[model samples]
Target chain A: MATLGNSTNIFWHECPVGKLERQRLLKQKGCVVWITGLSGSGKSTLACSLNRELYTRGKLSYVLDGDNLRHGLNKDLGFKAEDRTENIRRVGEVAKLFADAGLICIASLISPYRKDRDACRAMLADENFIEVFMNMPLELCEARDSKGLYKLARAGKIKGFTGIDDPYEPPLNCEIEIQQKDGVCPTPGDMAGEVVSYLEGKGYLHYQ
Target chain B: MATLGNSTNIFWHECPVGKLERQRLLKQKGCVVWITGLSGSGKSTLACSLNRELYTRGKLSYVLDGDNLRHGLNKDLGFKAEDRTENIRRVGEVAKLFADAGLICIASLISPYRKDRDACRAMLADENFIEVFMNMPLELCEARDSKGLYKLARAGKIKGFTGIDDPYEPPLNCEIEIQQKDGVCPTPGDMAGEVVSYLEGKGYLHYQ
Candidate 1:
């Protein structure tokens, strides 16, 4: 009898079709590319670009951005601190499932805290979790404010907003970082290519 | 400004790589084969067997049994009525994500409530949700008593057990029904073959 959290008497069910076979079928290794940054730091843009690039290369990939999940899977959750942690936990578990299904899961979120992000990393074994930091400066992101969220936060309309009212803890040892080049941001395609090349070099592009 | 539940001003991130393209890459249609049954009715066995069969045919699939999910995504839930409902809801949402990721998502659960199961069915659009009912007799499940759960339920050690104290509402119009033929239980491979045959007939075995 195995117990997990509040669940007792649970057993691990081993299926005959495991990850190796799935990778062979999809012709690519399963993994999670976690993109973390502030609201306007281009995390979702990088996720979308990476997904499109991988698809063009005949590689299977899926994006799990806040826009898709906050309404569906995490609908009951609010912007409170506890709810935010639970939100990240659930997304991490779901991303693990997508990786097990032999798809490159790209999770983009304004995951401001390092502890929550590290907890997600611990869920995946070995090097399956690849953290990509959108290392754009606060000033640059605030300047863009594409969604006007920064403006609202600065006006005290949105409480606990990341990089404005709340803290945005940067990753100390992320695998990849996407930042501006000489005060100029790189094109989406270029940033995506950078990640794709990393995946290729790491042998995540093939089943082996 | 879009609002969904407690989430306000959320946007839908539309990635270039979508379900159709993912299906084309996997060479099969993405769907959920939800196996519902009482305890000891061989739902997990059928799931494992089906997964193996799909593997032999060179198709991508993943199993989302309680053993895998209850300890992960749904760990925050419990055995209470409200927790059970939330558990099923989260599973339904995760199964939707798996389907969208272009895999044969096999979700094996003893979801005894009709409302909960129907709620899950509504989550998936069109014929994507294939409900497979394990219509075994209660007596048969009680006799098998796999995991000794039936004995525990009978002894009142386990409260609100399905088919014992709690209800096990059957599916009115599920896509497939697996039960003993002539009072003889089908072998696991035979049962898996039935589901595989259904998928093959439905053109789910190929990417159109």
Candidate 2:
């Protein structure tokens, strides 16, 4: 039952209130909108915009950004390689829970490793895991430098920082991609709309 | 900023759609119903029963028992002392996230340490963390031994088993307590009714 390192003899308990029933109540399919990109690529902005869009449409959605989680769930984890892997793993599991509760879970993270992201994708049904890659150029994100993180990384103050010292493995076959057109990046609303339309076309907008 | 041990320089991302809006959409206040008791104290039984009861009332509630989480979110953790503490902490954080998503989260765990349980309580507001103590006597729980855990513990096969080898510090001031009436253990429905009534009286069943 434990299925891993140490726990043993534990049994799985099934509840009567299952995912299908929750979906019926919410009137929308539950899924994870996983946004992956480099730092300063407006992942949080797109997440917030998508959340607002869903709310206005009478749909339930939640954003699992690092701000709320780092201070709480993943606070004990650091920026080490293993810590980052564990960090993404925990966030994936939490997102899965939010999805199971019949809400669209928007997870925005600068997850650099492809293996880690793939591992998270394996936790859910293939269709339920909607990966959205923010394919913005490093030059643009570094120029934005919204939080001065890029500067720190360039100055060698922050080692292994994503997009500077560490590599960001873009999603090979993401469900949606938010990229620039004619050298101009789209606004947060447009970016969110791109993902929303994908969700709609995929029949995630309604349960029935 | 990271509040605790390792994470640093992370900023809090505030979404436009918040708890109040989500509560309004769900028509119910979000909170955690934590059921704590001995192994055979019927915590999961009461949890599932209460979940069904809430669903019948058109309320959205999800149960986070070991059956669902230990194999996913907390699979990395074991039954070691420190691992147990981390286990409770992660559950508490996930419950907080569920509450923020505006769903009644039912968490069933045999968290014996008062301090660990209190730490979870401290994560949320004073009124939101409703601790339901299944105050069945140890002898009664041992006699039932639904999972044969007590028999194993008695045979010295399991060390540090709560209520057998480990100490189980009861809650000093819990929100609700379900106990035997006239030497007869209450049915799962009856125990769930006690909590449902409490939720009704406390105005958790509705939102303005």
Pick by lDDT: which candidate is best?
2
For B1-208, candidate 2 gives per-residue lDDT tens digits of 4336787778888888999999999999999999998889999999999999999999999999954678888887787899889999999999999998899999999998998999999999979999999999999999999889899999998898989999888899999999999999999899889999999999889996
Expressed as tens digits, the lDDT of each residue in A5-70 for candidate 2 is: 467767888899999999999999999999999998889999999999999989999999965688
For residues B1-208, could you state the per-residue lDDT of candidate 1 as single tens digits?
5777877657788888899999998899999999999988999999999999999998888899965688899987777888888988898898898888888899999998999999989999859899999999999999988788889888998888889999999999999999999999999999999999999999888998
Error of 2 at B142 (Å): 1.3
The residue-by-residue lDDT of candidate 1 on A1-208, one tens digit each, is 6677877767788887788888988889999999999888898899989999999999999999976798789999888899889999999999999898888999999888999999999999859999999999899899999988888888888899988889989999999999888889999999999999999999999977
TM-score of chain A of each: 0.98, 0.97
In model 1, how well does chain A match by TM-score?
0.98
Per-prediction fnat: 0.78, 0.80
Query: Clash pairs of candidate 1?
Result: none
Badly placed stretches (over 4 Å) of model 1 are none
